[model samples]
Target: MLNTHLIMEQIRYHPIVATISIAVGTVLASEVIWKVVQYFRSKREKANRVHEVVVFNELGEICAAQHLWNTRPGSQEPEAAHCRNTHCTLRNVGKIAEQIDRAVYSIDLAIYTFTSFSLADALKRALQRDVSIRIISDGEMVFSSGSQITMLARLGVPVRVPITTYMMHNKFCIIDGVERVEEIRQLRKRKWMRPCYSIAVSGSVNWTRQGLGGNWENCIITADEKLTAMFQAEFNRMWKAFEKTEASLIQPK
Candidate 1:
C-alpha cells in the first residue's frame, strides 16, 4: 500500500518536490489563463463582427407619396411636392449603389428592367475605376425607353441579353472578390475557415425607378459564402447563355 501520509510529508518538506508541484501548478494555471484569454478574444471578435445578412425594405413614407399620387385625385400636388424632396432618398437603391461603388474587383448584375440613372452612374464609376462589370438584362427591356443598358454598353461595359423570348427577370448582383470566396470555400472543404468578403444582393428590388422607389420591394444583402457562390454560378451560367452580339454594338439614339 502507498504511504499517502508519508508522501505528503515528503512533498511538504522536500524542496525538489515542492518546486515540481509549484511548476505543475503554474503550468496548469497558465493553461487556464490562456484558455480564458482565447475565449474572451473569440467573444469580442463575434461581438464586433458585421452582420452576415442585411435586409432593406422599400416601403413606408417614402413610397407613400407615390401611392397617394396614384390612388387619390387631388393628392398629386402635395404628393409631387413630397416626392420632389424625397425621390432621391431611396434607401434600397442607395444600398445597391453603395455596393456598386464599393466594388474592388468585379460586379455581375443580372437585372430585368434597369432604368435607374443613379445606378447606371454607379456602374459607370465602377467601370472608370477598372472594376470588371458584366450586365445581363432582358432582351426586350434593354430597348425600352429610359433603359441604361445601351448607354452602358456604349461606354465599353460588357452587357448581354438572353436570346429567349421569355423575360430574364432575375434581379440579383454578385459583388466583389468572388475568386477569394471560392478559394475560401475550397479551403473549407478540407477544414473550417472564415468566409471571404464577397457579397450577393438579391430580391424584388430591380434596378429601376419604380422598383427601387415606388413599388413595394425587399432586398437582401448577404455575405454568406455558400449562397454567394451559388449566385456566382448562376450568373456565370446566364452569362454563357446570353447573346453578347447586341451588347457589344453601340445602339443608335
Candidate 2:
C-alpha cells in the first residue's frame, strides 16, 4: 500500500514531463502550420495569377488600378486618384506609351491587336531612336490597322505576326526587360539606343486607344525584375513556335 501511494505521488509530481511534451507538441504543430501556409503561398499553379500579385509600392498600386476594371462593371475607367498608386489602368496606358517611347536598348512586344495611335507613335519613336524592337501579334485576328507593326518594321523594328492555333491571344510588352503583368515575369536583354528604362504591361487592354480610353481592361505596369523574368520566359517559349515564313503583317508575301 505504501508503495502504491508512493507511485501515485510520483505520477502527480510528473506533470513537468507532461508539460514539456505538450509544449514540444505545440511548437511542432505551429511549425507545421507555418510550413503549410508558405507552401500554398509560394507554389504557382494558375495562369490567372491574380492572387499572387500584391500592391507593395506605387508601381504595384497602378497595377491594382488596372485590375479594377476586371472587377468593376462596364468599360468604365477606374478613378486613378482613388486607386492605389502603382496599379496600371486603362487611363494610364499613356504612361506605358511614354515608357515605350523612352526605351533605349530593346523592346519586345506581343499584342492581339494594334490600333492605338498613341502607342503606335510610341513604337515608331522607339524605332527612330534605333532601339532594337521585336513585335508579335495575332495574324489571324487583325482587328485594326497593323500600323504599329508596319511602322515599327519600316523603322527597322523586327516585327512578326505569328499564326497559331490558339488565337495568339497574348497581349504584353517587355520594355527594357521589365515584365508588366502582375506576378508574371519577363526576361530578355535588348540593347537600346539610349540607356533608359523600359515598361511592361499586361491585362485585358488592347493596343487600340479604345482599350485605353474606354474599354474595360485589366493591366499592370511594372519594372520589377522578379516579375518581368516570368513573362520573358513565356514570351520566349511562344515566340519559338512563331512561323519564320511570316512577315509582321498578314499581307501577301
Candidate 3:
C-alpha cells in the first residue's frame, strides 16, 4: 500500500511536450482540411469554366459548342479553345447554321470544298428567309459529286469559282457584312480587340463532311467586326476576280 501510494504520487505529466505534440497534430489536421477544401474548390471552378464556353443554338438556347478531335481527345485545358489538337469536335455545320439562321441581312461565304448537305440545307434556309446569300467555292470541286454548288445554285444562291492556276483555299463565312461567324475559338486573346458582332466563328474547317466531322482540324468562334471586315474584304476581292472571269469560265455543274 505504501509503495503503491508513493509511486502514484510521484507520477507527473509533462505539459510542454504534450502541448507541443497537440499543437503539431492540430497543424497537420488543419493542413489536410485545407487541401481537401482546395481540391473541391478546384473541381467546382473547372466545371464552371467548361460550362462558360458556349454558343447559341438554333432555337435561341445558349449551349456549349459540341467539340471533338480526330487523333486525340480534347486536351481538357482550362481557358483554351481546344485548337491545339489535330482534330476538334466543334459542331461545324450546326454552328454555321445557327449563325446563318440568326442573320438579319446577308451572308457571304468563301469555302474551298463545300460538300455538306447540312450546310447546304442551312444556306437554303437562309435564302428562304430572304437573307442575301453568296458563295465562293473552288472551281474544280464545284462540279464534283459531293459538291453543293449545284444545289446552292438551284436555291438561287449565287455561287462563284476562282479561275487561277493556284487554289483559292480560303475557308470562312461572313454574315451581315460585319458579322464574323467563325467556328474555332482563338486561343490568343486580342487584348486590343473585343467582340463587335453578335456572332462569329472561323478556323481551319471547311464545309465538307470530312473537314467538319472527321479530319484533324481547328476552328474559332468570335464576334469581332474588324476580323469580319478583313475576311469580307478577301471575299469581295475573290468574288470580283471570279466574276470578271466567270462570264467566260462559268459552266453548268
Candidate 4:
C-alpha cells in the first residue's frame, strides 16, 4: 500500500511538468502562426504594388498588364519567343490613330527616320479630326518624298523640330494630353484619374510602309505612368524651345 501511495505522488507531480510542456508548445505554435500571417500580409502588399486597377463593365476589376511587344514578319529576327508573337505588345501607328478619340490632344514623337505613308495618313486623319498634334524629329527625316510637315501644317498640326548639335534619339509617342497636363501641374488630385493608358510603340520600322507593316519591329504598350511623365517633359521642353525659334516654312514637295 505504501509503495503504491508513493507512486501516485510522483504521478501527481508529473502533471505540473506536463502542463508546463503543453504551455510552451502552445506559445511556440502561436509564434509560428503569427509568422505565417505576417508572411501572407507581406506577399499581399507586394502584389498590390505591382497590380494595376482595370475597369471591366461599370464595376472595377483590378488587373495588371505588363509592358510587352510584338514584331511583324520579315525585318529582323527576334531574340526569343517573347520577342515575336501576337502575345507580345505592339500597335501600329494606324492602330494608335484609330484608338484615339474624344481628343488626340498631343502627339510626342522623336523618330530618327520616318517615311511611312501609312503613318503619315494616320497623322493626317488625327489632324482633320481637330486633334492637336505635335511632332519633333531630326533633320534626317525632313527629306521624306512626301512633304509630311507641310501637309501637317496645311492641316494645322503643330510640328516642331530642333536644330541641336546632338541627335534627337527618342522614339516614343503619347496620345492623350490631359494626363500630360495633369502630370505637369503636379496636381495629385487627379493622379489616380488617368486618361486611357498610353502605349510606347517602337520597332525596326520607320514611318515608311516598308518599316511599319513590311519590316518586323518590336514595340510595347504599357500603362506605365512614370514613362509617360518623362516623355511629356521631354516633349514639352522641346516644344517650348522650338516655339521660341522662328522656323522657315517648307514648300510642299
Candidate 5:
C-alpha cells in the first residue's frame, strides 16, 4: 500500500512494459471473442445441415431441383448389397423409375406430390406391359399445377386421392416380381419382363421434380421380402379407399 509512488515511477519509465501489457490484453480479448463467434457459427451450421420434417401446405411452382439435400454432397449411387441406406440426387432419380420399369407382376405406390414425368413414363411402360399398378397421392397437391397426376390418370393408370383435412404426406413404391421360376417363365412367355429381384423404396423424398431434381431428399431401397410385403399391404389398404374400375382402362385380371 505504501509502494504507490514506486509503482508509478516504474510504469512511467518502462513504457515498453505498458505497451506489451496492452497488446497482451487485446490478444486475449480477441481470442475470447473469436471463440464465442466460432461456437455460435458451428451451431448454426449444424442446424442448417439437419433435416426436419416439412409440412407442405401448398404446392409451389413445381420445377426442377434448385436445392441439394444430400448429407454427402458428391456421393454416388449405393452399391447393391449396400443400398439399404442409399441416398440419391436428382440424376439418381431415374433409378426409381427404372425400378418401376422392371416391375413384373405389379407396381403399388403412393406419393405426396406426383410431378415426375419420368416416373409417369415408367408407369406408362408398366401399364403397356400389363403390369398391375395403382397410385395414391395427396388430394390437394396431386391436382395442382404441373403435377403429373392428371397425366397418369388420363393414361388410364389407377390413381386415387384421400380427401383429408390433413396432408396425406406419404411416399413409397414397391416393385413385385415373380417369386418362382415358373411365374417368371409364364410372364416371359406373354412378352412381359420381370426383374430378377423384388424391391421396395421409402423415404422423405417425393416423386415430384422438386423432391428428386431440386430439393434435398433421401430414400432407401431394399430387397427385403418382408419389408416389401409390408409396404405392398399398406398400398393395397390405401388403394381400396378410392379404387374404381374406371381408374384403369385395362382392368386387372
Candidate 6:
C-alpha cells in the first residue's frame, strides 16, 4: 500500500521531485490545450475551404447575345431581336478575363482560336504586371483575321505554334499558383497555415466573341489540384513539342 503521508514527506525533503511533478503536469496541460486549439482550427479551415467548379454556357441568359450579334457583319437586327425582350448581358468573356487578371505568377494558354478583344486586353494587362505568359495556338488560326495570338507575341509574350498538320484544337488555360505556394512556404516557416490556390479553365468555349456569346458553348472553371496538375502536365508537354522559336509578329507574312 502506498502511504500518501510518506510520499508527501519524501517530496518535501526532495524539492526536485515536487518541481519535476509540476513541470510534467504543466507540459501535459499545454499539450492538451494545443490539441484542442488544433481541432477547432481544423474545423474552421474545413468550413471555409474553397474548392469550386463553375460552369459557363455561351447560349445561356448570362451571355450578352445582342452585343455579339451586333459585332457580326450584316446582322443589323435590333437589340430586341437578339434577346427577345430579355437583357443581353454578356458575362462569360468578363469572367474569363477576370481569371486572367487574377494571375499573380504565370498563365499557360493552349487555345484553338483566339480573337476576343476583351481577353487580349486582359492578357496585355497581365503582361504589363510582369506575369509570365506562354501561349500555344493553332498554326493556321494564328494568322486568321482578328486573331490576337500574333498581337500578344508582338507584346513580348512567348507564343508557340504546334507543328501538326491537323489543328491544335485545345481550348484551355492553366492559372499557376506559384505565388501562393511561395506564400504558403513562408507562412509555414513562421508556423502559420494557409491553403494554396491554383486552377484550370477549359471547355469548348474558345476565346472568341462568337464562342463567348453567339454559340452554344460550355466551359468549366475548377480549382481541383488533380485536374490542374493534369492540365499543367499537358501544357508542359506541348510547350516542349511546339517550336522553341517564338513567333514573330513584327512583320506578318
Each model's lDDT comes to 0.71, 0.61, 0.62, 0.53, 0.65, 0.71
Superior by TM-score: candidate 4 or candidate 6: 6
Model 6 scores a TM of 0.63
lDDT of 4 by residue, 126-172 (tens): 66765556677765565556646556656665566667677766666
Candidate 1 lDDT: 0.71
Judging by lDDT against the true structure, name the best candidate. Answer: 6
Tell me the tens digit of each residue's lDDT in model 3 across 102-144: 6655788877888877677777778887667777877777777
Give lDDT: candidate 6, residue 111.
Answer: 96
Instruction: Give Cα distance to truth, residue 212, candidate 6, Å.
Output: 1.0
Best by TM-score: 6
lDDT of 6 by residue, 1-253 (tens): 9799977886889889878987898999999999999999888855533354334443345534445655657653223333442324244455566678877667889999999887898998888887778888887898889999888877777777766699889999987644434543575585543343577889887888677666766677776778887888888788877765344323323
Candidate 1, 1-253: lDDT as tens digits:
9698977787878969868877998999999999999999878755533333333344334565454555566532222323443333344456567778877667888989889887888899998987777888887888789989888877777778867768889999888647644543475574543432567888876777677656667677776768888999888878777655554445534
Q: lDDT order of candidates, best first?
A: 6, 1, 5, 3, 2, 4
- Candidate 3 matches the true fold with a TM-score of 0.56
Off by over 4 Å in 3: 1-92, 179-199, 248-253
Write one digit per residue (lDDT tens) for candidate 5, span 36-81: 9999987774543312222222222121223223224664322222
- Model 4 backbone overlap count: 5
The best-first sequence of candidates by TM-score reads: 6, 1, 3, 5, 2, 4
Selected candidate, larger TM-score, 5 vs 6: 6
TM-score of each: 0.61, 0.53, 0.56, 0.51, 0.55, 0.63
